[model samples]
Target: MHHEAVGRDLSRKVHAAEAAVDHALIEIAALTAALPEARMRAGVSGVTGQSAFDDLAASLSDMTRARARLGGAHRTLAALARRMGLGAVAAGPMDKPDDQPPLDGSGGVTANMVNEM
Candidate 1:
């Protein structure tokens, strides 16, 4: 009975985490669509190039990195929750991802960024 309860608990956690990630992905997608890919790739040339666009680029870069970190952390948590009990999750081919961020970060252009991430 105890083991069964543990399995149930782990299952709940895993399910919740999955839902949270799904929601996060939607938000990330919106942020990605707003970014100007051309400008981001072009970047700014010259030392001390202190322009409004430069600052925006810096902010976006940071945001991308943060998103990557957040995905990693969530995966770690999900792994822990899944491991709590034998057969907590399913025993099958490891087809799921490690929750890696699809985008890379520059620094952190704004609170909303996903493309560079």
Candidate 2:
């Protein structure tokens, strides 16, 4: 029982980390998409210099590195979930209740339900 509790805590941490990574990836992708257009517009308007472009490129590179780190975090979380027998939580979208178990009102939560939350 103690081990199960510990596993639950770890699984929560893993899922939280994975969600953070997923959010970071989304933000990074958005920034990456907008940066080029912003740079191009600035260049066309003569309002930005080569140095500004270089700075934007550097920022994009930093975001790229962040994205990679987030990916690593996601993979690590997935592995931990698998170890905890909660691998299916990370398998894909939870579009159906059949993919999950109904709550028993026992003050205990299942992985699928937690993921949905």
Candidate 3:
């Protein structure tokens, strides 16, 4: 394949990866916000769906870790692209600047963090 073709393929893959990460993080956030509302809807009667809540929390934590790892992989891929002379390829939209601290190692951006920005 031509160099331009290879670069285009890499850029397309990067965009897809960014979208995946963004969607996963959004889902995680939604779940996080929903848990409390769900518990309230259940009405605290001693049984507060504690077990389910605990499980969800664990799942969210795992997802956060996974997001971090995926972010690292994204960064590595960006580095590889740079080495290949692709230059600075923008993966996706970022509301915050690069200098801002990431919510986690994931480096994943979301509108939820806009207040922090």
Candidate 4:
């Protein structure tokens, strides 16, 4: 098969993966918000459901690591596509344009950002 065909197939899979990841993150967010609400509804103090809240926080941490790993895989696939001479192909939806200025116009300089470098 041609490289273009392979790139298309990869692109489709990437999009699907991104969607699944996004959905899982959304669900996690919902649960994170709901736990506090549930605790409040139960007329309990914050300490009452501390254990469950801790577990949920741990799960979120695990999911974050998984997300970072997936992001790395996405970058690797992009590099492969370029090496295959497929040029720039759409892999998945981006939350925002990389070139776009940050709302504060600090260009991330003032932001507490994580860097792999």
Candidate 5:
């Protein structure tokens, strides 16, 4: 009976952890979703060719650059984890680029690449 109670306690702990991770992921999604509009708004304001827009424009641009730096950090940490056999690469080479042509020498036009033109 004591063992069963301990098992139940562990199961509840796992469920709570999973729920917390899910909530964090949802919050991350929300923040990324707002980036595009902020970028566009800042760009349009900056294009007035006026000096007054400089600070806000720079900050908005920095947000994107900072996000890119964060991505690099994430990749570096993920790679380190993979080297230690902790996790797999999040984006493997087998994940195809949408607009790339095939390298098989089939002399075939890739539809996605052709569509871009």
Candidate 6:
């Protein structure tokens, strides 16, 4: 019963983390769109110059940082799910090729090899 409860809790946490990541992605997209619009408006109004550009750059950098944080949250949630034996459920499908042999040379796997496989 305790294990089941832990599993339920982990599942909830994973869902919450996924939702948070989705929200953050949406926010990042919206901000990415708005930043350009804002810059354009500022340029048209003659109010945005070097300083405005700098501000927009900073905002973009901040958004990138937030997205990284969201990614970390997702990793943490996945770890928690794994601890509860729900990692696969949270991770979704694994379509990785099982027959792809390890790279044998320093040149790295070529595109032709991938295509042939």
- Winning model by lDDT: 4
Per-residue CA lDDT of model 4 for 41-100, tens digit only, reads 998888887887788788888888888888788768765765565544554555434533
Question: lDDT at 36 for candidate 4?
Answer: 86
* Candidate 6 error regions (>4 Å): 1-48, 91-117
The lDDT ranking, best first, is 4, 3, 2, 6, 1, 5
Q: Give the whole-model CA lDDT for all candidates, comma-separated.
A: 0.47, 0.57, 0.62, 0.67, 0.45, 0.54
Candidate 1 per-residue lDDT, tens place, 6-108, comes to: 6556555655655555566556555544445544566734333345446556556666665567557645644453344233333222334533332224533
Itemize residue pairs with steric clashes in candidate 4. none
Candidates, ranked, TM-score: 4, 3, 2, 6, 5, 1
Superposed model 1: Cα runs more than 4 Å off: 1-50, 86-117
Q: What's the distance in Å from true for residue 83, model 2?
A: 8.0
Q: Clashing residue pairs, candidate 2?
A: none
- For every model in order, what is the number of clashing pairs? 12, 0, 0, 0, 0, 0
The candidate maximizing TM-score is: 4
Better of 4 and 5 by TM-score: 4
Q: Whose TM-score is higher: candidate 3's or candidate 5's?
A: 3
What lDDT, from 0 to 1, does candidate 2 have?
Answer: 0.57
TM-score of each: 0.35, 0.43, 0.62, 0.71, 0.35, 0.42
- Give the better candidate number (5 or 6) by TM-score: 6
